[model samples]
Target: MHIRKDLSPGKQSLLTTGSFLIPLFLWTIVSYAPFIWHPDIKLQVSADRSGVTTVFTAGDRVSKEFFPTFSEAIRVENQAIMEAREQNKPIIGSRRDNLKKLRHLAPLAVANGWLEVKEQQNDEKLYGVWKGLAEGSLKSTEVELTEENIEVIRSNWRLLSAYAPTYDSKRYPTEAMLKLIPQGVSSNPVYLPAPHEVIQAGWRDFTTKPDNDMPTMWERYRHSLTIIFWGFTYSCLLGIPLAILCGSLDFFSKLHEPFIDFFRYMPAPTFSVLFVAFLGTSDAPKIMLVFVGTFFQLVLVIANTTRLLEKSLLEAAQTLGANRRQLLKRVIVPGILPNLYNDLRILLGWSWTWLVIAELIGEKTGLTGFIDTQGTRYNFDRVFPVIILIGFTGFFTDRFFHGLRDLLFPWTEEAQTGAKGPITRFILRMSNHSSYADRTKA
Candidate 1:
């Protein structure tokens, strides 16, 4: 199809900007929208009732009596302040201090419906919300009260809980008493988050002083790239020649098909244990995993792509008095060049999918490895950036190959549609110069 080339500069710019910005806008909406869906943040305590914790995840059921009384909140705040002062520090902490300011802001939180409470308490009320938080029925993380929030709480306590009741903690069966705080309450549609959280978490981790010998994000990315580069290189070395032979010779094709097909269907992950056992805990197993994952499929694709060469071109070459060897080299290989390049480009992307799987088998030091470790700790903020990095790396790599292909095969129909970029022009000039020199030598 003839694509329109008459777009104005403004329209072109708009298209270019939209192509990038639209996805980012959509992604942001998806990531932040969950806060709207599950707006209620709740104060939880550890399963053992040692201390208070907070959960940001939405969907916790709040009971009518879930909110702590003004006295209980004050007691918690006093404990925090005492602890901070004992440590020769201010009453503030650096993490999860939203509730620390609660003493001062409790009244505001209650007035704004950020905090909810039931007016009457009864023995049979069965504090479902309180039990859930205390017994670990709900997923919970212990958060520290920030110094700023502590000051906010102490100063604002009177205004915060003006109407809060006095209650006895021992009277309730719940080991932990939890107060519900609304982050946002909406039934509206939204998107989930992992990437944004990952980037944020990763940045935090990067900035924080490391407690151990964990590799940085750049180091992990470098390791992943190293594995993929070598694995893909090895796969091409073994696969391409085999694929060419299979495509050119019927005996080879028939003989290899059964074994190739069987191995391809066997699945790469199944070999994870085997590879580790055989290759040990080094990078060899991971590289081999990538190779196994890409090699057979790549061979099959290339062979099929080679077979799709037009019969007319082969016949024409033969008609021009070309022998079998020359026809195979000068005709079949050349005929399949553009298609083979595209096939390899696509397979290169497929190779990346195996990276995480490969890295999982032996060493856990790459981007995927870090993601796997942090994911268990619910640190998706760290995980998200690595995933995005993988995408960006793949996108730019694909573009690089595409541009390189255009430069190498300017005569192909794919190359003719767009204006040649500087790289293509430069290569074309070099090519012309080399051809001119060859002619002069002859």
Candidate 2:
């Protein structure tokens, strides 16, 4: 007697290793390609005694306008030195430069009440105030002035101040720099609708007007379930019977195969448009689109499975003196059951893709409809979340059907190991215990 093994240890090891390496390879390719191929653009900086401009490779840096220019930057540096002079603190420029003047004057300014420090606008404001005070026009008492008033004075002071002679005065601004100032200074930050605002606006438009309001996330989820339920119900009703007829009879197989194949390739969007025209823009069109989307695929699947059953199993049943009804009940139906379950799982996945087109036809609801509305409004952030939801839901649903398959066909080793839920474990244990008791008695 020979013992049969479906999977050998070596084959199993190979499969396990392949699975691990494939993912690692894919991740490496996806993670590294973008970085290596496309590096971030570098900025070009040009400076003259007048001012300095920074040109970025991409779109303008709008934040630069509020930030000081290079000339203003230098003035800020000079102001720091002058402040040290007022404070009689040692000035530190290059290591070689003497700080004796700043050190000598430091305490005198403090004693005279000329040097003042306060928790002002920021480092920039503090520096501006120090510059003003060092120049002798701004009083140390005015350091407590509001930022708005300080800014007014700072702008006036910048305009009146002469360029420092220490820095070079000649350099032509490049096209990049010429472009950078306007682009940087003029560009405004992109604004997004807040969640509260989005919800309020969506409701205002959706509730009062036609085709304006998009469905909420919950609404889309509910609609998805509804479409899946109805689509499955319709496909099972129409597909299984047609499959039986086509499988059992040669005449029907010849007649139906061509027609089913034709519909299988017909685009869902085209069908959606036609359904909308025929049925008008209502739930009927949406349901019909889902039906058409699922039906042809289910038919092809069931028909193929049924044919295999008839050829291999039905002949044996007929020889055993079984009538058509008995043969169907005992052999044909059970033989097709596993394949039918598998087909339904595939159809469920296809239904989601179809639902997108279905929802596009004046749906005003469901995930696809929500995506459409987001795209129209240019709300890419909102659009991305919906896409992620759809992917996760589809994955979970596929896992569910696979779980169902395992529960129904527990004789297969794949089924037993695939069962993940506690309830499935309980059922398997009870099933095993009963089988063991019968074996012991025998």
| Candidate 1 residue spans exceeding 4 A from truth | 1-13, 30-35, 42-211, 419-442
Per-model TM-score, in order, reads 0.64, 0.54
| Candidate of highest lDDT | 1
Question: Which pairs clash (backbone N, Cα, C closer than 3 Å) in model 2?
Answer: 87-105, 87-106, 88-102, 88-105, 88-106, 89-102, 89-103, 90-103, 206-213
What C-alpha root-mean-square deviation, in Å, does candidate 2 show against the real structure? 14.9
> What's the true lDDT of residue 384 in model 2?
55
Give per-residue CA lDDT, model 2, range 321-349, as digits (tens).
Answer: 99989977788888778877888888888
lDDT of 1: 0.63
Residues 349-392, candidate 1, lDDT per residue (tens digit)? 99999998999887786988888987886555566777877998
